[model samples]
Target: MEFLQILDSDIRPGGLIEWIPAAPGGLGAWHRDPRGTSHNHEQHLRSAHDYRRATRREGGREAWLGLAVEFDQQIDFPAVQGALLAWINRHEVLRTHVRLDGPDVARYTTDPGTVLLRRSRIGWYHDPRLLIEQIAGSFDRATTPMHWPAYRFATVARAGSFTLFFAADHSLVDGYSLVNAQYELRELYQAARERRPAALPPTGSYVDFSSSERTAADAADDRHPAVAVWREFLGGADRLPPFGILPAPPTGAGPPPAQHSHTTLLLDDDATRALTDRATALGGSLIGALLAVAALVYHRHGGCRFTTLMPRHTRHHVEFHGALGWFVALAPISVDVSDDPDFALALERTMVSLDRAREGASLPMLRLAELIGIPPEPKFVVSFMDTRGVPGAVEADAGAAVALRSHTYADDEVYVWFNRTPGGLRLHSRFPAGGDGPGEAGLAAFLNEFAHLLASIAAGG
Candidate 1:
């Protein structure tokens, strides 16, 4: 699936339909003082960070995640509504909201079967630009970590087909959950129309995940092993290294420009196989090959050790495999590389470093941060996902499914995500572009050369 900020934001439009949570019979869904549940460490940390940074927000930093897909015909509104509610009830995280007041944050959850939604037609929109702006603005306004039901859904209908859009605050869901939502919704939609139970398995609740994770983290002290990994990684530095993909910013300049992303395919299916085999020969997996190349690129820029932030999914519970929640843990990964070594040798080192890194990923970064006495923020992130064999992956191959993110303000940090699918490996990067980085043509040239080098490796060079 092609993940875009606003799915096909440049395309034309016809009409718009918005779906938002409503009080059943206008009696308030979150009434009767919902029961408080344990908010995960990530959620509590996110709330505290937002509270600290709330005063400095500029141009409304919209930090929502979204997904948009199309169906051949107009939506069966009633059937879709039933399916949506069923899907929401299936994932308890969607039914929960954060209470950001008090000294510490808490989560209050509404029970299933008590929630309702309303469909409102906002008239026709022949202009695509205005339509996109309206949708994005709604998402920015509706989605905030501190609010209840921080999400929005809409339908953009055309002559014979229509697009379904769904967005939520990033705290409530991760990239994997956001992509899988469309698949689950479609399954429920079909069953709702057929008036039969969906042929899907039950999902575990994120509530339980939060409770268990928090209990374990609270018991961890500064002496914890994970805490030591983080302390060693950031002992004295205020923050991690900024991705040196672009020229350094002038010392006197203000904050760097807002982040921009570049997406490109790195290798094709055949090339991926060849490269995978090559990587296996060098180490034990493909990540070693990927990390080796990236470390070398930084090495060329005089970066001795490849250090960056990485995300590790906490999906150990098989039951939560299909559930939606922010079941992600962040960890720091660093590997040593040498200039004299061949690429194969570098991969060997990377493979060993990766195993050590895996063993170090015990607690969430925020919990580790609390142990290390630091703040949690983004800087020099490198993420990779192997999406070759997931359910509904075939549809993504055709590019119907996509994960979306809202506009974000940034300083000097850079983030790159690598996705491995049957089609190939794709790279998507977001970085400070104007104040410190290369211009339009310069960035394109850099990316083209980067892709070419990776392609050569894939070709067995």
Candidate 2:
């Protein structure tokens, strides 16, 4: 799926139609679930910090993930409302509320039927740019980690078509859940129109997953192997891995630079398939080959080694795959490319580095941090997710699905994701903005090199 900002999105202007959740009734007192994990609690602190820092800086907001979808048919209010409410009821995570307790986060949940949405016609927008700015601001204010009902749903309605937008705090959802949500929501809307039950699989509750994981992780201590694995990976490094490819701003000259993003077409479908076969024939997987390509590029640019944190999902079962929640663990992967080895040897080192993933994601990042004495921010992440098998992601992307966590204000944070889409293998990165003009050009140059290296393997060079 293409994760993007609304500024990068293609949306038409229209009258706004929002199905807003009413004030939750019968909410039990916010009490800490001892079964709760530290992941969300840690994020709450980070969000608070980001919000305060962002208010002083320019365009940035706290962490929120979102998706924008298109509807080209005539409006159907009743069916749409039914579909939205049914969707909210189906996901137990949506039925809950969160608030910051003294030192921890507390949550209280209501039964399915209690959560209801009231329809409102917000306004009309003729200028698409103004509409975009308005929606982005609305989303930034709508979902906050410290508030109850941390998600909002709205549709920018047109004559015979509309674009539906949904935004939720990052603590409530992840990229996977947002991508799949398009499929489920459409099915629910159709079923609502027909007055039939939506044919959806039984989804496991993230609440239960959190409780079980919290209890299970309570057994971990300093002697745990994951602890050792994380401790070694960090090596007393506090901030994220440095960007040897880009120039850093003058030290202490000012606040950290704002961030920008770049996405490029690495290879077409035919070349991607050939490259996959080539990697297989070389006794290395596609992921390993891609990592080798990146390591080579990093080393070519006067780097000592290539190192990054990778995200691994905690959804071990099929059921959790369909749920909306932040269920992920971070693992460290570093490779010594200073030897200047060729693709074969680099792939070998890449494979060895990947072995770290097995243990790094085994524990929650918070627990890993407590074990290793490092905080969670300032992380340099490089992740590869082979999502070619995921049904409906292309359709969702066609409908303008965006991740919406952009407009960040970090100085040294960079996130890179390699996705195996149905079309081809592609990588997108968010790095230091470096004040815009030269930053964009430099990232493009860097990614072009990355693409050529992959193309070399695909063409048997």
Model 2's alpha-carbon lDDT is: 0.73
- Whole-model Cα lDDT of every candidate shown, in order: 0.70, 0.73
**TM-score (C-alpha, index-matched) for candidate 2:** 0.91
Instruction: Please provide TM-scores, in order, for all candidate models, with all chains considered together.
Output: 0.89, 0.91
* Shift of residue 270 alpha carbon in model 2, Å: 1.7
Clashing pairs in 1: none
At residue 200, what lDDT does model 1 achieve? Answer: 85
| Candidate that scores best on lDDT | 2
Model 2 residue pairs with clashes: none
Q: Report clashes for each candidate as comma-separated counts.
A: 0, 0
